[model samples]
Target chain A: MSEVNNKKLRTKDLIYAGAFGALYIVLMLILVMSSGMVPILYILAPITVGVFCGTVYELCVLKVRKFGPALIMGLLFALVACNGAWYCFVTATACALLAELIIFLGKYKSKFMYLLSFVVFNINMSCPYMIMTFNRDGFMTRARDYYGEEYANGLSKLMTPWIWYALVGFAIIGGILGALIASKLIKKHFTKAGIV
Target chain B: MDFDICVDDSGAILKLDPRTKLVMFLTSSVASLTCYSMENLLIYGIVLCVITILCGKKWLGVKSLLIFLFLIFFRYEIVTSGKGSAAIGGLLTSLITIFLFFFPVFMSLMLITQTTRINQFLAAFDAMHMPNIVVIPIAVMFRFIPTVAQEWDGIRKAMAFRGISLEPWAIIRSPLKTIEYILIPLLFSSISIMEELAAAALARGLDSGNNRTSYETVKFRAVDYLVTFMFIGLAAFFIIGRKGL
Candidate 1:
């Protein structure tokens, strides 16, 4: 019975990976197509890059069969496409990797991966942001141009609090949506299909 | 299906070298990103539209469809808005501005993807100082994804034969037996492939490359320099201290 269940999980993970990878490619093209016409979609692209990376990583990396890879992949992809900071790329990738390794410790445990995804994305996305406060080559560096020294000096107070809240909100909501939707689908239909 | 947009028949574009295309794309994408205003975006958009159209199969006669979509979308957005004239003008220009951002680089992406074989694409990146870790892993991922996708279809069909429901939620709830049987086999297949891949890449001189060369070298053409300059000018206009975005 254990062997049978393991096979099913492996198959399901592969199928999900291919499905999401195609979805990522299409989403990329569609976003690029719409990027011309829609400004809001611009914001969505950087976030989705990490989500794609995460998806690939989960379906391909974590033997536990988690959705954390997809979330991180989506978020990373978005950041890269947006030409966001170099740190965003490194942090996003590192976060997903760290999350997967941590969740791997739980060893096929339930609901642990979901919490892992949320926590990792929050820490990963926010730390670089705080680090950038002193980063003269950073976005806050550019802030000085628009807001001057007083505004720049107070940037941590000005930006960090708000951005952290926003990052946490997005990661939790997006991570929940990704994991729940994937888990529910896999459990109901794909599991029986021998896709585990 | 190895789904992609229309593949260009002339593989000549591939011969041009991906590094060249990458540079072009970087210039154009950066230029577009730096500017948001109407006048600058128009200048960028016109040049992009022309370049994009030139990249594809002209005889397919997509020109009419392209123009029609461009006009209808732009015109209706501007005309329908109940804003004042300046605002209306701004809206229309905004539409054009958006178009510019999408048009050129997308053309260049399609151009390369259509012409270049996957092996060559990887080889080109390999030629660049791009790290093997990034290139090699991503290549393996793309190659595995399609094979696994096909395997998945087979598993799905097998399930459907047993009258199993395949809806998203339905699949999610299916029991543990299904996972162990179908997915593990595919996972094992993927692992098995890696051994062969390692052997093959090792055998094929993929690793012994202190003296690698290409059939075609990417060099800066006059037109490339011109295009690059134009992009630099536009980007500078947007980024420089005096002018507005």
Candidate 2:
């Protein structure tokens, strides 16, 4: 176990990350695109993605048993899904780094640590909304002009600071649920098949 | 017999360097984030679409432009005009707004992925002296997206053969079963595919840890410089001149 922890990520590991990362991105894109249509679902987008993507994340981390996959996954997510928003990019990378640290502290063997890291990593879902929180007035005025008064008003009511907190809270809960589901699936199928 | 000189004719009218494409992608992404006004966003989108067309993706450029224009029209004319009920109009407005906001980024993404080849990306990243950690995964991803799409089609067919419906109504009715059915097979297939890809890559000496050479040589030409500066100028304008606009 220690030897595995100390080993550097090989080219194959990187390829595996790319493959799973692609799957993760595709799934997240479908989830986000489908849910992004409605306002309520858009608000819960992080949770939705977290719940669905946990299985991929868990598989990649467990298979590689290394540090780089999560970081690579974060970078891929930032590049693919963040829409070039610098804030989102920064937040996503930061969350991944924090997750990496947490997982490292656990030496990649602790299930509790992996779950905790995922919960932390899932906070990146709030990145797209960060601009809204920071530039509320600017975003609202633009929304008002483009989307009109009532739409802007409704958006403003939903863009409060407390809502951001609630979003983070919901993301953590979703991560927990997702990690639980992933663990069950891993035990049920992946372990038996010797894939993990 | 006269020996004829073979000219490399790839049909790309404007062959900008991959690095230039990277710059364009980043600039467009940053511009999408900073440029708030609809008119400005439209201009940015049009400029990118024109670039995409010049890169030999005429249909893609035209299609993206049409969709973007239609979204803008729908938002302003139909939804914002107060023709429908408040509930449905608001929903449509928000949806369209999100699409509009990210349209430029998506356009640039498509532009890069479709116009640039995997070898070009690898060669460009290699020239930029990026570590393998960053380069390999990205190259693999660019190569894998199409494969994933293909696999997804197969999975959909297999599900249908098994009498499993992936319709929205069916999925919503039993979400967990739907997830289990779709995700399990996809994961299993993808894992196998990755193993094969890794073996192939290793056999090609990807893990050789030497300064690898490539058949495609990436270099910056006049067009590359022009495109790079143009995008940089646009990004600067978006960031600094955003206030006046």
Flag clash pairs in model 2: none
Query: What fraction of the correct interface contacts does each predicted structure contain?
Result: 0.03, 0.62
Q: Write the per-residue lDDT of candidate 2 for residues B60-164, one digit (tens) a residue.
A: 778888888888877768653767687877767777877787677777766666766767788889898999998989878766766677777889999999999
In model 1, which regions exceed 4 Å deviation?
A: A1-22, A28-57, A63-80, A84-94, A97-111, A118-164, A189-196, B1-6, B9-15, B27-29, B53-56, B59-101, B137-237, B241-245
Instruction: After the best TM-score superposition of candidate 1, give how far the Cα of residue B225 lies from its true spot, in angstroms.
Output: 6.2
Interface RMSD, all candidates in order, equals 10.9, 2.4
**TM-scores of all models?**
0.54, 0.90
Q: Pick the candidate with the highest DockQ.
A: 2
**Candidate 1's error at A95, in angstroms?**
3.9
User: Residue-pair clashes per candidate, as listed?
Assistant: 64, 0
For B39-145, candidate 1 gives per-residue lDDT tens digits of: 55456555554544454534322553366357546644654574666544554554543444455445444444444444654677766667543445344434444
Cα displacement (angstroms), candidate 2, residue B111, comes to: 1.9
* Tens digits of per-residue lDDT for model 1, A112-183: 564455346434434334334434344544433322344345543545535545555555554544444445
